[model samples]
Target: MPPIPIDNEGDPRLAAYTSIREKDLTSGHGARFIIEGKVTLETAVRRGRFALESIFIADSRIEPLAELLARVPADVPVYTAPQSVMDKVTGFPMHRGVLACGLKGEIPDPAAFLESGVSAASTLLLLSDLSNHDNIGACFRNAAAFGASAVLMDAQCCDPLYRKAIRVSSGSTLWLPYAQGGTGLDMVNAAKAAGYEVWAMTPRTDAASLTSLPVPARLAILLGAEGPGLPDEVIAACRAVRIPMSEGFDSVNVATAGAITLSHVFTAAV
Candidate 1:
């Protein structure tokens, strides 16, 4: 189908793309979430699990992105607007000049999702109470980059499908099989029941150094938010491991720590 032309910022068809920053801060994108940039939009088209509702791009991008746009299913609407209108509509500069909206789809039962999505020897990342969108995005990127089979997040995590999170992830959240819901302990127990060797990532002195810990055939690394880290009971429920850091520095950014640990697991698995 030919691209639909959008001339005005108030075009009702572009309603989903308007005031993006405000929507992200408030009630959120609801059943639909926005995708940003060429690379992330490409990821959404090729590898994303969710269905694309429609695509909105700057008019100037039409020719440059022609080949990529050809890959989009013809049935999905593609809207093109002037760069000025695009910026006004989205409440941002519209630098990359591309966006898409995607359906959230039905969230599966967390336990069933793990049981069906993972193998007996799978590597997994379990997240708990991570409120930062960037950290959530980075975790998905790390999980995908390091060959983790799936990611499981507890009830308190920020939405990985949030616009900024999706962009920060470079769209990994679109492809990586992940389930978000349930309590932290519920996540741990689900992984344990699935026969995974659950490891709580913490900086506590009693935790074993990651370099010394053996990677199990089936491993789940659980990470919590930055400040409080994992709860004491949660840490006690599993094998505890810490990345060795220099004297007087026991911690790293949670996402950075996740990347380091996932790298260790990926290295061992290979």
Candidate 2:
């Protein structure tokens, strides 16, 4: 399809691309989310899990991104605008020159997603009150790398579809299946009911080390926010396991912790 030339910043056709940074915060629950940068946009186009509602690119990107543009559905609008217009529309530099609007389907219930015939050796990750977008994105990237079946997060977790998160995940956010909603305990119970042995990652001295714990036939690892870690009640409900650290160091970034734990679980399972 020939790209539509967007001359006017206020054109209604470009509404989805306007104030993108702000919209990334308020939008996405009702099926729409923004995709930024060439890598994530390419991932979105290749995955086909989310419908491409429209695409807006800086005129400078048209030639370089021609291959990716060709993969987009013919019916989806592809608009090209000057760098100035693109920056004005999105309220940013638009340096990457690629942006897209995507429509995602409803998130499935945690129980249904867990019980949906997941393999016995599968590993799942549960996040609670994880409000940092970068950590969410990095965790998703780790999940993709380790072959985690799905990532489930409580309502307090930030949206993984947020533009920065998507970009940081290198578009793995689009490839991985995720469910958001419900409390930490609710996630633990659901996983237990679905035949998963839940392991809570904590830094407590008494907890078993990740290397020492036995990998279960089916496992779900629960990771919490940075400082507080998992709620005491939530930790008590599952087996508490820790990654052994040097005596002076008690913690790592949640994303790094998740990656280390996921690698351990995946390698053990294999």
Candidate 3:
């Protein structure tokens, strides 16, 4: 099966990639979202192993894409054109010659999510008000690397399936299970109801230190985005917890903090 080759900017096959030009990532006729650039492309394909629909490149990079060219399915479309056209359509000079789109999806319910983990698994990153795709994606990558069983984002958070998040996660977003539409409050209740101890990551004076908390058999670490921090009600909903930090700096980036917390939890208990 030879690859589907498309060269024209106006080609209908390029529809998904095209609307990105108009900044319409999607309007709901069902199109795979795209992540553009080399790092993201490599991550999306190899690490996340996302269900990629196709790859697009410019005429100038037939040789550059060689490493992945052979691996791409023969039936997947690969589009190329003069640098001028790709640049005009994409709104910038191309760097990767590799733009790929992937399917949108949701993971199963959290109970099923918990059941999928190894019996000895230890930690989960529970995200509440994470709105930035960059932060959410990085959190997933951090969770994956630090041995968190899974990453969970509240419905108020951005879709982990969004292109920016998928790329920021270095495709770890795809590798991890994600759910949508549930809120921070719902996550806390669910965590408690499921028998997993919930630790709301907050900097309040009385919060227990991450390393000092009685490590539980199953744990969910709740995180809020920076600036606003956790809502008072959300923080009050769980046993409060905080990461140890240097003097005068009582905080870490939510993603970095998640990594640190997960590292501690993973080694301490199931």
Candidate 4:
């Protein structure tokens, strides 16, 4: 389909793209979420997870993205506007000049997804109360890199579908299968019941060193927010493991820790 011209930012068809920053800060993108950047957009299209509501791109990007835009279903409208209009519509400077609105489907039940969505020799990443989009995205990227089966997050965790999170993950969030909601303990219990050994990552000196423990065939690495870390009760519910550091240092960034632990599991499982 040919690109449709969007001469004005206030056009009703551009409603989803308008005031993006304000909307993201308040009610979020609602039933649909925004996808930004060429790479992330490409990943979203290739994954075919979310339904494409529409795509909005700067007129300058049409030729460059011609091949990619062609792959989009004809039913999905592609809107092209000048850089200034795009910036006004999105409430930000149009840098990458590519954006898409992806419609979310019904969220999967966390327990059922854990029990049946994954099978033998699977590794899952469990996140609790992680607020930073960058950290969440990095963890997803690491999980995908190490071939983890899926990611599960508690109610307190930030949305992995957040635009920044998706961008930071280099679009890993677009492809990764994840379920959100439920408590940390709820996740741990479900994983345990599903035959996964839940390992809570912590900084406690007394916790078993990660290097000292053998990686399990079916493992779930549980992590928490940066400063407060995992709740005491949540940690107590699982086998606690700590990554070794120098004499004084006891911890690393949550995402770094995730990469380290996931690499161990991936290497051992393979």
Which candidate number would show the highest lDDT if scored against the true structure?
Answer: 1
Report the Cα RMSD per candidate.
1.8, 1.6, 3.0, 1.8
TM-scores, one per candidate: 0.95, 0.95, 0.85, 0.95
Clashing pairs in 3: 155-181, 155-182, 217-270
Q: Which stretches of candidate 2 lie above 4 Å from their native place? A: 25-29, 116-121
lDDT of each: 0.89, 0.87, 0.72, 0.87
In the range 43-129, model 4's lDDT, one tens digit per residue, is 988785778899999999999998998899999999999999999999989798999998876656468777675535478999999
lDDT of 1 by residue, 1-270 (tens): 889998999999998899888885223343888998999999988888899999999999999999989999989999999999999999989899999988887665458787785444378899999999999999999999999878899879988989889988889999888887888988899889888899999999888999998788889999999999999889888999989999999999999999999999889878
* Model 3 bad stretches (over 4 Å): 1-5, 19-31, 47-49, 106-121, 267-270
Clashing pairs in 4: none
Model 4: number of backbone collisions:
0
What lDDT tens digits, residue by residue, belong to model 2 across residues 193-248? 98889999999999999998888878999999999899999999999999999989
Task: Evaluate candidate 1 by giving its C-alpha RMSD to the native, one decimal.
Answer: 1.8
Writing each residue's lDDT as its tens digit, candidate 3 over 41-105 gives: 76666656457777777777777767766766666667767776676657766666667777654
- TM for candidate 3 is 0.85
lDDT for 150 (candidate 3):
71
| Over 4 Å off, model 4 | 25-30, 116-121
